[model samples]
Target: MALEHAILVSLLEQPGSGYELARRFERSIGRFWTATHQQIYRVLKRMEADGWVVGRDVGQDGRPDKRSYEVSAAGRETLTEWLREPVQPEAVRHDLAVKIRGAAFDDAAGRARLVDEVRRYRAGHEETLARYLAGERRDFPAGGDLDTGQRLQHVVLRGGIAYERMLLDWLDDVLETLLKGLP
Candidate 1:
């Protein structure tokens, strides 16, 4: 999916300045779609030019005025059309998976390197899983009080948590097989 759609969804959730949107991407949206601050700004400009989003300048007491953006009617239409399109499964592009297979040709030292890398990767996933769990606890403390959007967002976060756990488990399996010299 394009970054545009992600931005639209985020704005719909709550209209905010470019800076605010970037922070949201860093905190929540980054789990599913990642874009740098520069990218976000660039897209916002394009989206505004296309008349898909409208921006308003808001004055601040101690800072420069920030332009807050919201979805225009055209933007909502575009988003709805995109939603109706079928989503294809994402293509896998895992460099570590390729490296794991390449380890078959490496000597003892290279194998050791692979093990270390696997451990590092697993550590990252563990951290992400922890973050997802914390977010779930903080955001959804009560089960029945959530609105439809909140419930959907929580479910997506749960999917992310599950995916990270699955990757961690698979990495453990890979580490065991590699260390044991199993074919």
Candidate 2:
């Protein structure tokens, strides 16, 4: 998906200034698609020019006015069209998988180094899993009256949680393999 699409979805969720939108991307949307602050601002400009988004100046006390953007009717149409398109399978490019395969060509010492790398990688995944679980608890609490959008968002978050859990399990297997036959 293009950055415009991501921006459209974000704006639909809630209208916000560029800075606010960038922060949302860093916090929640970053889990799926990442965008730098500058990139977001640039896209917002293009989207506004395309008449897909409307921006208005929001004044603040003791601060500069910020341009808040919201989806225009054209933007909703564009998003709907895009949403109806067939989704192609995403290409996977895993550096760690490549490195693990490359280990077969390396010396025992090199393999030993890779083992430590795997351990460190495992630690990072563990932390990510913990964070996902915490977010699930906080954002998607057990017995709440959720509207359709909230329910959909919770499902997506659940998918992220599941993905992280799977990654942690695979990383554990990688660690075990890396440790085997090591002197």
Candidate 3:
């Protein structure tokens, strides 16, 4: 999906300045769709030029005037259209997998180091996922009546949890294989 679509979807959630949108992406969308602050701002500008979103200047005391962007009707239509389209399988580009594949050429010590790195990475990701879950549970209680926005946020959170779990499982399998001396 184009970064523009992600920006438009974010704007649809609520009107926000570029800075606010960047924060939102880091907190929520960044789990699945990674984008830099510069990329987000650039996409926001392009989205405005394309008539997918409208920006209004809001001046606050002492701070610089912020341009808040909201998704336009056209943007909503575009998002809906994209959602209905079939998804293609995403290409895999895992660095750890590449390292594991190349471990055959290395001596035993080098292979052991690569396995250690993978273990560290897995532990870090697991901790991050735990944090994400804790925050979600705190923000939205299970039995609460969630509005559309809350529901959407929950869906994204679910995706993050599943992805993290898959990564953890993959890491375990890789660790087992490496320990067994199978290239």
Best by TM-score: 1
lDDT tens digits, residue span 21-51, model 1: 9999998998888888899999999999999
In model 3, where is the ten-residue run with the lowest total lDDT?
1-10
lDDT of every model, 2 decimals: 0.92, 0.89, 0.85
lDDT string, candidate 3, 12-118, tens digits:
77789989988977877777677888988888888889888999999999999999999989989989998898886876778877898999899889988988899
Off by over 4 Å in 3: none
The alpha-carbon RMSD values of the candidates against the true structure, listed in the order shown, are 1.8, 1.6, 2.3
Error of 2 at 112 (Å): 2.2
Better of 1 and 3 by lDDT: 1
Please write out the lDDT profile of model 2 over residues 35-154, one tens digit for every residue: 999999998999999999999998999999999999999999999999998986876878999999999899889999998898898888788778878988887789978999999888
Task: Name the top lDDT candidate.
Answer: 1
Off by over 4 Å in 1: none
Error of 2 at 124 (Å): 1.9
Predict model 1's lDDT versus the native: 0.92
Task: Return the candidate ranking by TM-score, descending.
Answer: 1, 2, 3
- lDDT of candidate 3 at residue 32, scale 0 to 100: 62
